[model samples]
Target chain A: MRNIEVCFSPELIHLHELQGKIVVVVDIFRATSTMIAALANGIEEISTFSDLEECREMKDQGYLIAGERNGQTVEGFDLGNSPVAFLKKDYSGQKLAMTTTNGTLAISKSSAADEILIGAFPNLSATITYLQKQKKDVLIHCAGWKGRFNLEDSLYAGALVKSLESSHEADEDGALAMKSLFEKEGHQMKAYLSKASHAKRLQNHGIEADIDFCLTLDLYELVGKVENEKVRAI
Target chain B: MRNIEVCFSPELIHLHELQGKIVVVVDIFRATSTMIAALANGIEEISTFSDLEECREMKDQGYLIAGERNGQTVEGFDLGNSPVAFLKKDYSGQKLAMTTTNGTLAISKSSAADEILIGAFPNLSATITYLQKQKKDVLIHCAGWKGRFNLEDSLYAGALVKSLESSHEADEDGALAMKSLFEKEGHQMKAYLSKASHAKRLQNHGIEADIDFCLTLDLYELVGKVENEKVRAI
Candidate 1:
């Protein structure tokens, strides 16, 4: 049994440490979820570029380009970070290249990992089972709300830890804190997260519908894996 | 029945929001605990500053200037953030002007609070009692380790929340999570907290001695509060 160690923020992680490890990148806010949705709907593959200019080049290459800046779809991109918006597309056999403010950055940084996959609540169970089978020491990277720790990401990390059972080892206080959060609160995420500052901000921005949609679980059948800087659906 | 809020990060607060309320600024690492020790040992008053340059200037003004960077004493100051250091000088009828990376920023930002107070585990009960008597909304600002969530601050917030009993309402999920943490794990803060990420970091930095000092309970008789951009013992 390989050790399963989860990191709550990307800032705290040293990329060299995760080398040759099976890493799962979780940005539950909307990016990972949107990516999963885009792939699940049969988008050929997603070229996740950290550079907006590269994403634009891919868009110009006749691909369905989806990108988000500050949680909204970039002015010219075909979609935004909202998981719901991607579901509106007919991605059958089409390739998608996307960029996001936080999630893509996290995925890009984990390029040295042995394997990198996307995770969200919708695919949480599947992700866990697969990781357990791979049985490599797993590190769950929480894309914190802009270099700051947020309850939503930590809570999700906690839930993953809880579901993984004895395979998990919390080497840091954040891991223990999330474990405590899960042990006490036990995963009523939507209700618990409704009051989050970001959720509140998003609600105030008229994306209230997306918040509800984002909270829904098991909506996508896509499992995204990072291959050569792009997450292609397996 | 005053409102009690939990600030998970220092970024969420501005100086203006704390005006005229009993704001509890917590830096469980060592600063707040040192304040509790100095005041409890019959120190007259305490002044908090965010700038080390200002602290240097205060030394020339005949005030004791003590602080730390990277958990060690500043090269020229009278003392560092260690509670052990504060116990050396009898502060009766004297003033302390201090600066630190985390706690001092919390003090500066909360200068507008009707009364801003330092909260640490050593004086946990007394701090809660003082806030209870004041009978107004209490905001627990955790001076997270370098501007992010730390277990010690959240635990103290949980301790205060658990102390409020029927008199307080759970204001937000951060508080609720804290309350839950306190309920389940408050009884063993040291065993749990001494193992915290920051605590371990301190231990690695050779300041593990300070950790033991910070976790002590009810060790001080003085309450430290802030006014005019300074923390003065009241």
Candidate 2:
């Protein structure tokens, strides 16, 4: 039986046994959603960097830069951290350098994993289909808000676990708790998530549309995989 | 309105802004349950120590010692960690020195709080009454298994939040997730907890009855307050 565990926040990245596991890095509020949208909108490949200077350096090398820190777009970047910004944009053979407060940091820390998949509501079904094919122990790593647990990522993690067809055991209390929360609130996700701290934080910044778009399920059929410090459509 | 938060594990203690908050330390599997039982059975005060050597020194000073590491009773200690061990004991004016792998360590780390209260299912009603009287922002600090999240303590934290009748808001996602878990599974707590990892660990040691006793609600009418390294009925 494949064991499924959900790491509720980036703070728990160190506690997880990531080696040999199929890690699904989730930042449903924006990062992973933007990647999914970018890939679907024809961005060739997205290079993820944890450092702003590294992303900037890649931007200087003729790559489109997209990132955010504390919910604000990085200065001089070509695009902000909104999935809507990537929509309808065409860059068939170009590269996009990306960074974010939580998602990329989670990806960098999870480099020990055998495989890494980017997960968000927009790519939910595709991610689940991919995981069902792999049949490995799944670890949903939620990129919470700045080292603290956030609702949206965990809710998406729970949604992923709930959609899996295989029999699995929760590795810890966090996993069980997330599954229960997902089971309880899954049907009312949009309404429930409106009360989430990060959602409120983003809404306060006049970005409520981003929250609605991120919560939309299966907007892309592409599954993002990490290769050579970048996320490419697999 | 008071803001209530539940730190699901010691990993989250630092993430929370615990200053000036009334922190309720919960270790429902045994430690806090034993403290409630000890105080209910007439022990004057229990001095909590995080160090094994400190607990040993107090034992030499004629205080009855009780502690466990890796779920086993400490060698040369007067009692094991089972709450039932404290029952029917008479030490009306005597002190007990205590330590445990998770519980005391959580208490030691949460010294920055405005006030600290020892919480367990056995003292559920009393704890609720005490918190209701205080009217401060509450932070339920769960002493999870060795710094990782565990089920029982989080469940008890949920129960505490569920019991409070005051107008309160969850400070973060962890608190809201826990409260939802409690609301969904509160009625079937014993059966639900039987599947917890710590429950299996304790059951392997042939202490399943301890689990039942620990899950018992309101067996004691005492609320424990920590002062000068000791827990006293308050």
Candidate 3:
């Protein structure tokens, strides 16, 4: 099997290098979380865009324009990048066209990868289990805070490395390092994230309710893929 | 004081944005650690050169040529970026010209800051105390691995943010994010660090001893500074 590794941040490493690999794009701060929640809540299909203008155009075409700009819900859009919003029963069976600050950028950038799937801490275990059986080279691309490194994303990357330890190879220095972190803290999911940036960001803002919801693992078995300009849950 | 809001790696926040602030260059995967060690060992002064050739030219003038190339001691150099090696007795009163992969690059880039001081996890508390006395914006420029995000460096940034918490202005998103990390596992320094990329690199190479030594807080009072052509401890 081709060895799998992770590039913690998409900006730090290019998607071109990930060609032929099954790339998992992760943005834990609401983007991937929202996608998972929507899919789990029975959203039929979702299209993703990196550019807000494109998403707006899609919105004009009657698609549900759902996304976040600067961490808040967009004024004119049907939805924002909150997992809780996506979890609403009304979102079930509707199509979603979304863009987000970091997550969508990472997903758009991973176009060169053989197959791209949305990754989040909540669905980490299931993602790993699914990928391992396919015998493919995996790249965990952390959609860090707008192309810069953020701890929460890297933590999830480390968590993934830990979960896939038996089947993957962390070929680079950073990847190897993240793997060690996974080995050190994979079992203590809540404890591992208790001190993370996003956790506290949510806490300090009095949005503490989202923290527990974001950390829930294996909440979705559906794998979201980037195909035809949108992330479709399959 | 100008508020120094730093966004950690994989996040796209620029180091230049921290200009006119007291930018503390941090790189624990040896440069900053070696700086503290070099000063503790009585190296009178250090000069940093962004270019390896400049360091080489300084080396010929009876300076103790110290640097690491690809994480190992360069040919004919007196040091190899290891803090333990820097503690040897022979380094006393020596003027050394140093170079390294990521750390020095940041030192070079940060020349425009109001004031620049070197920082590392090893000197966490002392650096904070020193920064607290000054009334300038503080930016912790993590010496990311080869212009990219590395977990260990971000962790150091987090450590600094954690220490200066009472200084609330410095404790914003970047600071708060990192502080939360320290809040969770800061006291368990070694265990907390065992999760980083640098530690694992050393561990994989069987050079785990330095990782332990590099985690010691306030082991030295010396501060590394950018001077003449190099960043040396004074």
The weakest ten consecutive residues by lDDT in model 1 chain A span A7-16
Compose the digit string of candidate 3's lDDT tens values, residues A113-136.
888888876677778778888768
Q: CAPRI band of model 3?
A: incorrect
What is model 2's interface RMSD?
Answer: 2.0
Can you rank all candidates by DockQ, best first?
Answer: 2, 1, 3
lDDT of 1 by residue, A136-192 (tens): 777778776665455666677777777776775665555677788877765476677
Number of the candidate with higher DockQ, 1 or 3: 1
DockQ of each: 0.27, 0.59, 0.21
Cα lDDT for residue A149, candidate 3:
54
lDDT per residue (tens digit) for residues B15-72 in model 1: 2257666788998887888888877766666777778898789877778888887767
Sort the predicted structures by lDDT, highest score first. 2, 1, 3
Per-prediction backbone clash count: 8, 0, 16
TM-scores for all candidates: the values are: 0.74, 0.95, 0.77
lDDT, candidate 2, equals 0.82
Q: Name the TM-score of candidate 1.
A: 0.74
Instruction: Flag the better candidate by lDDT, 1 or 3.
Output: 1
lDDT of 2 by residue, B1-234 (tens): 788888867777888787888999988878888898899888899988778888889977889898776667888888878888777567788889987767888898788999999998988998888888876889999998777777888889888877773566764677777788899878898777665565676788877778888899988788999987789998
Predicted model with the maximum TM-score: 2
Q: Candidate 3 on B154-191: residue-level lDDT in tens?
A: 66776777566666354344464455445555567677
Order of all candidates by TM-score, from best down to worst?
Answer: 2, 3, 1
